[model samples]
Target: MPVHRPGTARREHHAAGVLLAVLSALALLLTLPGAAQSADGENVPPRGSARMGQGVLEHDGQGGEPRGGDAVQTEGVDVSSHQGNVNWSALWSSGVRWAYVKATEATSYRNPYFAQQYNGSYNIGMIRGTYHFATPDTSSGAAQANYFVDNGGAWSRDGKTLPGALDIEWNPYGAACFGKSPSAMVSWIRDFLTTYKARTGRDAVIYTATSWWKQCTGNYSGFGSTNPLWIARYDVSPGELPAGWGFHTMWQYTSSGPIVGDHNKFNGAYDRIQALANG
Candidate 1:
C-alpha cells in the first residue's frame, strides 16, 4: 500500500526477471525503518517472499542481505503470490511476528497463493491476516469488500487471527485518485469499511499513505477511530497521520524490510501486538 511518488515503484520492484537482478546487484541491506539496532551486532536477512506495493516483491532466489537489527520486537510483512514460495521458518527466525497475505485485488483477482501464504504464516506461529487491494473505480466499495471477504477476508476470533486490511493505496493504473472525486472517494471507502465491519464484527484496518489519502479522499477524517490506520511510507520518518487520525495503529516502514512485500510494525510493543493476535 505504498505511494507511487517516484522511486516508489516501477524500476524498484517486481516479481521476476530484471528488477530482481537490479535489487540483488544493489546489494541493499534489509531492515524495517526505525527498527532498533542490535547491541550484539547481529545481522538480519530479508525474508524471502514477494511484496506487492506500487509493484510486487522480487522472485526469491538470493539469500538475505545483512542489515542492522537485533530481533524485531513486533515486525510484520505483507505478501502476494508474486513473492513465490515463502520460507516461513526463516521468516519467523528473523523475528516476523505477524503477516498480512494478499487475498483479493479489486473484485476478480485472487492471489494464486492465498491459502499457502495465509496458512503458512499461521502454521509458523505468526499472527496472520489478509488484505485486499481496493479498486473503487471498477465497482462500489461494498462490492469489492464482499468479494474479498468471500475469497479470504473472513475472520474468526481465532487467537492468532488479525482483522482484514483494506489496501486502498495508489491506483496502479488510471487516474491518481482512482478517477473518483474526493467526496466520492471518501464515500466509497466508508462503504467498504462499513460492509467489512458488518461481516467481520470488527473494523478492518485501512492501509494508505498520507499523501495518497489526502489527494484521493480530500483527507477525509471520519474513519479515524472506527478503522485503525495502517500507514505506508518508505525511507522517511513517519509523517503526519491521515486526516483525523490522532494516532496510528500500524506503520509500514519499508518495502525492503527483512521480508518481501511491505515490512511493518505495530505502534506499540510486543505485548500490544500480542494482545492483538490473541483477539
Candidate 2:
C-alpha cells in the first residue's frame, strides 16, 4: 500500500479544474460566429468571407469625392457575408440601382449567405451580380474561377444579372501579392479571366487598385483591352487607371457609405448598368 502525501489530492483536483476551464473557453471561441475550425483543429477566420475592397481602405486612405454631383453615374454597393442578410428594399429606395455580392474565396469556401444577398437584390429590382475574391497563393486561378462559378458566380441573360467579377486586390491573408512575381501574378490573372470567360461566355470584370495593379502585375496592359475595369480608388477622380484602360467601368469611390460600408459608382448612367447586365 502506498501512503498519500498531504494536500496531494487537493493539488491534483485544482490542476484538473484549471485544465477543464481552459478547454471550455476554447470550445466557446470555436462556436462563435465567423470563427471556423480548420482540419488541423485550428481556429481561423471564416473562409469565403473576404469582402471586396477589404484591403483598399486599409492600404489607401479614403479621398474626397462628391457624391451624386454633376457626374452621371449609377449608385451601387458591394457586400460579403460580413453584411449578413442585407436590407435590399432600403437600398433600392435610397437610389442604389446595382449591387455585387461576394460568392467565394480561393477554392475552399463559399458564402453561406449568398442566396439571401444575391436573390434578395434581384427580387427588389436591383441589377445584381456576384464576385470572387482571388487567393492566388492557395490554388490556380482557373480552379478558383471554377469554384466560384460552381458556387454562385454564374451569369444569366435575364437583364438583371451582371457578369461576375474577379477581385484581384491586395491579399488579406499573407503576402501582398500572394508571394508571386509580377509575371506569375499576371499569368494567374490571365488564367482566372480566361477560365471565367470560358465558363460563363462573358468577359469578367477586373476589380483592382491602380497601385496594386502596378505593383503586383507590373502594370500589365493586356487585360485593359479585354476585361472591364472596376477600379478601386477613394480619390476625387479615381486617381489614375491601370495601363491600357482608357476609362474605368466602375469606380469604388468610398468604403464608408450611408447604409453599406463599400459603395461604388457605375461610370455611366442607369442605362449603362442595364447594358452591362444585358451583356
Candidate 3:
C-alpha cells in the first residue's frame, strides 16, 4: 500500500476548494432572483413588480415628460376581460397604440376571455396586436403553441396578426403541471417559438414579471438575438433597466389607467417596438 504525503494532499484539497468557490459564484450570478419584498416573504410573482399596497409611486417611464429630444409615443394595453363587458370601439379611440390578448394557457386550457374579446371586437384596430400563451407544465411546448394558434386566431391569415408572445411567469402556487425549473420553462418557450416561427415566420416576444425576469428568464440561453422582450416592472421610477437584456421593446408600467366604456381601468405600456426593431 502507498501512503500519500500530507503536504501534497493539502495542496490538492486547496485547489478543489478554489474551483468550488468559482463555480458557486457563477451559479449565484446566473440564478439570482429579484430582491423585491414578497407578502410574508413568500413567492407571489405578479405580472409586474408586486405592489402589495406599498403606496410606492410606480412611475411611467414614457409619460409626464420628454427626454433626450424624443417624444414618448408608445402606449397600449392588454385586455382579455373587462368587468364582464366587451368594449371594442372605446379601446380604439383611447390612444391605445398596441394591444396584447391572452390566447391560450397551459394544461389544455384556453382563455375564453381572449375569444370573447378578439371576436367580439373584431380584433382591436389600427395598432399592433399579439397573443400570449400561458405556458403550463401539463402540455408539451408544441402542443401549447398549437392550441394558442388554433384558438387565438393566429391561423386566420389576416393582415393584423402580430408576433406571438410567451407569458412566462409563476402561476398560482401548486400549479406544477409545467416544469418548475427556470431553464426548463425557458426551453419550453424556445421550443414553442422555434415551431411557431417555422410555421408562421414570425419570431416570438417574451413577457415576464420583473422578479421572474431577474430570477428565471433573464439569462435564459435558449433565446436568440432576434427575440424582443416585453418587461413588466412597477417601480417608483423607471431607472436603469435590468442588466441582462440589451434591448426591451415594451415596458408595462402602470395598471391604473382609465378606458372609456369600461368601469374598471386597465394596464398598459409604451411601445418602443419600432425603435427596437429599426435599431
- Listed per candidate, the RMSD to the true structure in angstroms reads 16.0, 4.7, 15.7
Give the 10-residue window scoring lowest on summed lDDT in candidate 2. Answer: 38-47
Estimated TM-score per prediction? 0.74, 0.84, 0.61
Where does candidate 1 stray beyond 4 Å?
1-52, 55-73
Q: What would the per-residue lDDT of candidate 3 be over residues 79-165, giving only the tens digit for each residue?
A: 553323556667667765555656656535455565556554555553344455454556677876776666662532454445677
Q: In candidate 1, how many Å is residue 55 off? A: 7.1
Q: State the TM-score for model 2.
A: 0.84
Clashes of each: 6, 0, 3
- Clashing residue pairs, backbone N/CA/C < 3 A, model 3: 137-177, 137-178, 138-177
lDDT values for all models: 0.75, 0.89, 0.53
Highest lDDT model number: 2
Candidate topping TM-score? 2
Query: How does model 3 score by TM-score?
Result: 0.61
Error of 2 at 273 (Å): 1.0
RMSD of 1: 16.0
Error of 3 at 247 (Å): 2.2
- Which has the better lDDT: candidate 1, or candidate 3? 1
What lDDT is obtained when candidate 1 is compared to the true structure?
0.75
Better of 1 and 2 by lDDT: 2
